[model samples]
Target: MTTWRDVQAAAPEFARRVQSLFDAHKHKTIATLRADGSPRISGIETAFTDGELTFGSMPNARKGSDLHRDPRFALHTATVDPVEGNEAEWPGEAKIAGRAVHSGSIPDGPDGDLFRADITEVVLTHLDDSATLLVIEWWTPTNGLRAVERE
Candidate 1:
């Protein structure tokens, strides 16, 4: 099992990388399951606040609609590095899964809901190290995103 220490140890680098990827409005694709169990992908504005990630949607939109139908969704952020003279490119991606939750003030007053997700999985790809970490799979609403196992 990985501990908070693991995440903490990597936080500095991870945060820097994440910020670099998200600089000045970089859109990402948010994937979720349709009611029919098919995959749905859309580009959305991704934001991070105090280490927590969030995505917004219009009232009763499809992304929100999908969430209502099935809260399971995944967020992916990726980038491709093209090194001059190198015939190949190295791509990095991070994927996180969680249930969509409604939060913010929805104009409906206190009755409004904001969307959120309890990050269940965090995939970090470090090309220089040729390694990736798939972490905290066992996170539950009751226990939170503490690492469960490491392989």
Candidate 2:
């Protein structure tokens, strides 16, 4: 179970970890729902703006189409071992629970598509080289990501 208080406390740390992996990891997997209740997944290079997340893709992609129909989305951002570096492979994952809605009229470049998700739940799990694995989970009132006051 996760509480708003915990989320408030951990959000800064979470943001830092995420930023570390953003360009280095370069790949994020997003899972969305199909109309028939099946799962659709895709790899995306995510962009975060004003606390909202967005990505670029073809209009026909399953994720884009699914968002049109279902609007719900889940994002998993993970890190892999670097080829050679002083940086340790701190495997971390964040679960983003939010609704996907079309943001722009024109589909071009980074401005192509926009998804404003009211991330309500963020569960960050990481394997620490110096310490044991750590897991932090946070939840919102609606149970999943929706509109909620930021900490």
Per-model TM-score, in order, reads 0.63, 0.68
- Highest-scoring model, lDDT: 2
Q: After superposition, how far is residue 124 of candidate 1 from its true place, in Å?
A: 2.0
The residue pairs that clash in candidate 2, if any, are 120-145
User: RMSD to native for every prediction?
Assistant: 6.7, 7.1
Indicate the residue-level lDDT of 138 in model 2: 48
After best superposition, candidate 2 residue 99: deviation in angstroms?
0.8
TM-score: model 2 vs. ground truth: 0.68
Q: What is the lDDT of residue 143 in candidate 1?
A: 49
lDDT of each: 0.57, 0.60
Q: For model 1, how does the per-residue alpha-carbon lDDT over 1-151 read when each residue is reduced to its tens digit?
A: 2222333345555545544555534777789888889999987666665555666776666777888778888777755554655423333455666777666644333333456556655555434432233233323334444433344
